[model samples]
Target: MKIACLQFNPKLGEIEKNQNFASGLLESYKPGDIDILVLPEMAFTGYMFKSKEHIKPYLEDAETGITIRWAKAQAIRLRSFVMVGYPQIVKGNPDIYYNSICFIGRDGELIETYSKHFLYTTDESWANEGPEFKAINVDSLGKVGFGICMDLNRYQFKAPFDVYEFADFHLQQRTKIVLCSMAWLSNNDNYNDNDNNHEISTINYWCNRLSPLILNNNNDIGNILVVVCNRTGIEDSTTFAGSSSILSISPSTGSVHLLGSLGKRQESIMIIDVPIDDDT
Candidate 1:
């Protein structure tokens, strides 16, 4: 299957602009050529919207909202499934919002939705942390796990890490692809105007340190493939260095392959062909 990862800098609180940008990317692909397209966390409304009230009008229902409807149409038109993140208001609890990743199947069906299990400190003020750790299944791709930005960092936590570890073990027992959506930030010094020779070294260190964890786990139970899409640009004094990529793990030898950086703070789509095997 060919999976595309979209790495881009979204204009903060600009939903229509972001959606238009996404549509342009989708238009470039031929029908049935791409199987899945993964987008970053809060792709619709960029991270760090100043007010919840301001951001509220842009929130969409994962199943039937205009965003999903447009995505569904694109999925059906392109014959590809889409996994994109957006802020959603939970039904019956209007006051509380959730950071959600919605899965739209190739036929435009609402397959499943996964709310972020781990919310960053900044997100805690506006969104509720998801209580469930569930995996979604795609027919050609096998069972897939969905996680947001901070959820990756949660692997360092004991209890949540245990759960994630087990989830990895179980997915390896069935599938090969694990999908992640992120709104990640590099160290502030890396992007500062006054250049420091050590800043480049610092950025590389942080990227190398965190990148591999997305591909192979410490437990070594599964040889999984990771497709991560992250946002770029600065928000509220925090700058996201968009180095989103696809990390592939060889099931037979556990070898790892890193493909595409998509450049910092720019929008682009990366396509990778993932091979599935009997052992994988």
Candidate 2:
């Protein structure tokens, strides 16, 4: 299967502009060229809203939101599975909202939806915590686990570092693929100026966070795949750590391989074609 990550800087509160920018970036790929396309958390709507009232206008209907419309269009246009993050208002309840992600099948239909189970600082300001970790079965991809930016971190970043809630869930479920959309904050603000060090650091940190699955590699684990699609550029005072990547962990050798990755300042898609070995 071929998977692609679209990484770009989205202006705050400018949803239409961001959507056009994303569409233009994906114009070159012909339909059916990409098997799966993933975007960063809050891919178009910028993160960092100050409060619920601050993001009120941008909250979308869980079933008919603009983000879902865009994702569905892209899914149909590319003939690929599309996953993106957006802020959602629970149906019939404008008072409740969640930072969520939705999956669109190749037919432009909603396949599944997952709200962020772990809220980051920014999210806590305007969104409610979601239910729990989950894995959905997509006929084409086997069991696929989902996670947003903060989900990979320790619960509220206060739990034992070794707990690995997200990775552990996927391991227990024997998930074949893991999809993560992130607006992960950058530790170094100057990373865009040809400073490759910080980008490497971020990638390493992510790999380590998911090391549980790598270390527990068994025949059942075969070749577990992970797609981390992150955005770039600074949003107000916050800068995102870009270096979106695709990786594979081989159970037989207990090894992790980097399939492809984007740099800190790139505004493009990182695509990789992975061959599945069913027999392990």
Report per-prediction Cα RMSD to one decimal.
4.5, 1.6
Cα misplacement distance, residue 61 of candidate 2 (Å): 1.5
Tens digits of lDDT, candidate 1, 205-248 = 33343344344544444556667777776777788867677766
Off by over 4 Å in 2: 191-198, 278-280
- Pairs clashing within candidate 1: none
TM-score of each: 0.81, 0.96
Clash numbers, per candidate: 0, 0
Whole-model lDDT values for every prediction: 0.70, 0.88
lDDT of 2 at 75: 95
Model 1 vs. true fold: TM: 0.81
C-alpha positional error of residue 79 in candidate 1 after TM-score superposition, expressed in Å: 0.3
Q: How close is candidate 2 to the true structure, as a TM-score?
A: 0.96
Which consecutive 10 residues in model 2 have the weakest lDDT in total?
Answer: 190-199
Clashing pairs in 2: none
Native-to-model Cα distance after best TM-score fit, residue 215 in candidate 1, in Å: 10
**Tens-place lDDT digits, model 2, residues 215-270:** 88486557889999998888888888888999888766777888888888788888
